[model samples]
Target: MAALDMLEREPDLAFSLNGLARALKVTPMALYTYFGSRDDLLQALTERLLSGFVTVVDGDMPAIRRVEAWCFAARRFFLGYPQLLGLLTWEGGNTSVAWFDRSVVLIEALQELGFKDAELSRAIIWIWTSVMGAISEEIRNRTAPHSLSPAQVESLDPRLHKPVRDMLMLAEQPDHFDSFFAYHVERLLDALRAIAKRP
Candidate 1:
């Protein structure tokens, strides 16, 4: 994570084996001992990041609650290491198991709520995509603004924040936020339940 942070902060610096070795106060040969190559080091870093998610999930929690916590945990993890999002395209050897286990738990929870296997799979995919897509857009907007002018912000469409804004505003009042998430969860569960009931 430290090496990745340095790379993110100094994109101009060449991120090679020697460079990283120097940054870590180690000889290039020493790094090669632990990681066979530059790609191997990157793979190790990716695995470390993925494995951290497993530690974030509370095994003692109910499956539904665990799913909710996992979603939030994932969001927080991705937000912290936005640069690591690019690593998702590459296949990490043992690191992928954490994500698969989490996904299975989520699917199982939905299935317990009476969703058909196929429908539960689709719902899980849709929910995760929606949340991650929203976070990605927010990160991109905050980091790289196409138009810096004040007029651009003023002229921007308000409709973009309508859904989230409304939710936030309502959630400000006591107990509303809890009710809001519960409402959405129930709606999602009901939809899945309907699919399960379908002949």
Candidate 2:
């Protein structure tokens, strides 16, 4: 859709039927023929954005590893389309059919490890939230200007917030985003592994 292409090219542009119609060289009423309302259009855009999300993983791998692979792939997908940040993080974000399609991959893997009902649901929520959080943070770090400089950190009172000062200093260095992402992914996998082994 031309509207989707416009969004991908300029993500920050506020989405409106009027704006989209103008971009497409059509009247707002023309869009109403396709989308019932703004909410309908938003859902369609989200579905289109996430339709390609579930890439094939090595099915022969352990179920836990397969799920882990899904998490990493999800990270890459978000990074590729940072515009999804606003859509997926807000209200009604997970209501679209594509969201369930992507989530079923993890659900099946967790089911293979004996998870069911609430436990399975909780695991899915945990993994999805973690991936979304990491991707959001990574995008902010890359696009937003650093708030504190090394010199600013040096000027802080020595008696206060040592860890904050230290963190600021470290923040000045190149971010090891992949390594940081892998660490959290491992931690989440560890928790899932424990859950799978429960009596």
Candidate 3:
């Protein structure tokens, strides 16, 4: 918990046994009593962060709606702990099995809707990527707030790219991000629903 507190306080700080020990006001050797290595400590923290992330939706709900609920829930959960995103990205190949295990409910849900091996894998990847991509955009918007100026949008030729200009204008307002993310999620689920219906 102390490690997580340190991480939340300084999200960019790299994990190290020495650093964590210092933060906790204990000797580095004291950490070794609880963790075998820095990786072990980090993995424990990661598990704590993700332990309660379940994607199970009510069976009474439409299968596609279940999937949509999972996607949105994942986005909201990860957005709450943006630091976990960076840790996961940095760990990459070294990530723990717990990370992949979080998808079991999602995989089962897709299976119920007729997805099989390869298709199921692809669907899982698409759902996760879309959620993560949206979260990344949201984090950027919240932290950096980069948006095109009206003058910049107007500088583009309207005749050639009116829609592009309009999109640029819309991007200027971070308030619309949730609606934009929802629109894409719905479109993606529509495509998945069509595929599920196919024989």
Please give the clash total of every predicted structure, in order: 0, 0, 0
Ranking by lDDT: 2, 3, 1
What's the TM for model 3? Answer: 0.80
- Pick the winner on lDDT between candidates 2 and 3: 2
Report how far off residue 17 is in candidate 2 (Å).
4.4
* Residue-level error in angstroms, candidate 2, position 188: 1.0
Cand. 1 TM to true fold: 0.53
lDDT of 1 by residue, 64-159 (tens): 565565556666666666655555544444234345554665666666656566766787887677556655754564466333344544465767
Estimated TM-score for each candidate:
0.53, 0.81, 0.80
Least lDDT summed over 10 consecutive residues: which range in candidate 1?
89-98
Q: Give model 2's TM-score versus the native structure.
A: 0.81
Kindly report which residue pairs in candidate 2 clash with one another: none
How many angstroms is residue 57 displaced in model 2 relative to the true structure, after the best TM-score fit?
1.0
- How high is the lDDT of residue 195 in model 2? 87
RMSD of each: 6.6, 2.9, 3.0
Predicted candidate 3 versus true structure: per-residue lDDT over 1-199, tens digit per residue: 7766876787655556577789999998887687887678667767877775667677688777887887787777766666666555334357755677787767777898999999999998888787788888877787786655667767778773677666767877656778888888899888898999999
lDDT of each: 0.59, 0.77, 0.75
The pairs that clash in candidate 1 are none
Give lDDT: candidate 3, residue 83.
62
